[model samples]
Target: MSGEFHLSVVIPNRNRAHSLARAVLSVRDDDAGAEIIVVDDCSDEDLSAEYSQLQAMGVRVLQQDSRRRGGAARNRGVREAGGTHVSFLDSDDVWLPGRHDRIRRFYAAPGRDRTVLVSGALLHIDGDIRRPHQPDWRPGRSLVEYCYRDGGRVQTSMLSLPAGIARAHPFDEDLRVNQDTDLAMRMDRAGIAFHIDPEPGVTKEESPRPDRLTTGAETADLSFAWYRRESGDWSPAARSGYFLQDRVWRLADSGRRPAAFAALARSLVPPVSPRETARRALSMIAGEGLYSRLRAGWRQRAPAPADPGLIAAGERWRDLDARARAFCATARDAAAGQPGTIQ
Candidate 1:
């Protein structure tokens, strides 16, 4: 078993015990040979039973004293992992059956770049799976280039970078939101190529309840400090973030718009390098157009009746369902000619 373990699945989980159980169960059911590590980030709820269950299935549980953010937790797990390749799974997301097997196969494929990170599909699911307004990825393109050309939304859950790359470019713990995007972009900058499988490899859970959206935004805003720190570098990821910040401003209400605008204004400042400045400008423009279209399409989709289970879940765990719903509603109204009212 030790000799055969070629991949390590690192899952950083906080207080979401139930969701964590489901995610780990998905891996256990797949019977994948990868070593599983669940890093507990000072969760208030005791997850001893879940730990025992995972251990029974050959998972290693690492407990951390401080509640470092998820990126930091993932970094800690990678340090403790023992595999040739490393894959990340968010606590709320699930790997479809055979995801690990498929990823390993991609790695083993002839003519594939061993140094290149491989990723595939990520279908967003709330109560039920719904198609994203925009394609998560394009077919047969360099994942790194795709991220560079567009804004980085590469699903880290479906990504498997070589052990060396993961060691060299761990997730930026300083970022609370958009950290995955930042990490992916950094990997690309570090010269890691990427291959994306055309099939769905993971499920990203989306919740559309009101309070949930605000919380998501708040948590997302926490990463702005990190963004400010990296503002000197106008990488594709940073440009993507700039467009994202502008959209955030567009969605901002009367009071928040000032702050949002201030952030966007800051992004206009050029990075020191000429190449970086040009890349940043291109990324901002590209991300803006893409973000606009996607938001428009989301508004076009018919809103389903609010799911009570989702709302209840939002209530219990400060889920993003409400916020997602609100965003959808605004999009819908905007699609129908009523300008979206920012919250």
Candidate 2:
């Protein structure tokens, strides 16, 4: 890669000093000529020791004036970065091996410009890295399909673009969740060409952290409204259909069949009847695992989610079916006692 397109890697850190080292090391581990910048988001405890070690290792560290959260930290990093091309690394996640080499070659292609945003795929690393996760569809010359129709997709580590775009369309500092998605939509609106790669770009580390907003955390009403507004340009039918589809997914993933069925009973957006919509929703959820009877029937964490159980098991042995039914019923009752709405 030429010096003209040097990469600046920005990692926003809070309380994850333990993981911050590995995140920084990942960038330094690669031979890519990228500057590493760490923006601290006012962590509660002092991480000065950790920060100092990184600084000695040639990683630059910047402190935020206040605890402005991930989005603000990232925006600040962009302001401080030295390279023309900027990329992000969440403090808790690490770059996969060979990422720098793969990406450098990709962007070094002739005619690749400041206007092109190249995004790659991710492999989930809980204990291993076999299970990969990518967006359902790739973005194209047009923004309509990516933003409005494809149900808003993008991740922080999967992206790399020009610093000018990052500065011009900074992450919405006010938004606690979906800030990346919000910024992606803004970049799309600003006419940045979106490019996607199928290769696993990063290895995401998923640990249950208390400081982090846990699952089901709701977005602020205004942020929610603005994000919805961004997609408001979609045709009414397309917008509503996506909305319904999203709700159905949440309910089914949580093993909330009653809510899922109730959501299905609502009117279809258009060109589809309620019954047909319900049938489709059921089929989709059933593929998640048609244990015992319903999604309501099984409340266990998906046995092997990466495979996604899209195909049915050949036969349902009577003994196995009975055991599944009893297990699911017990699990559902236990979950019912827990309070809080599924987002």
lDDT per residue for candidate 1 within 1-343, as digits (tens), equals 1234388889988776566766776676566577889998887865555565556557788888788878888998888889887889988776666777776776776554435554554444345454332234554544433543343347668678767678788887766676776787676666666665655566666543343322445654565555566556565554544544333433342235455545454444432234434443443455645644564576579666775633433342323434333433443444454322110
- TM-score against native, each model: 0.65, 0.68
Clashes of each: 11, 0
TM-score of candidate 1 to 2 decimals: 0.65
Candidate RMSDs in order: 12.8, 12.2
Q: With candidate 2 superimposed using the best TM-score fit, by how many Å does residue 30's alpha carbon deviate from the native?
A: 1.7
User: Judged by lDDT, which candidate is best?
Assistant: 2
lDDT of candidates 1 onward, in order: 0.60, 0.61
Error of 2 at 80 (Å): 0.8
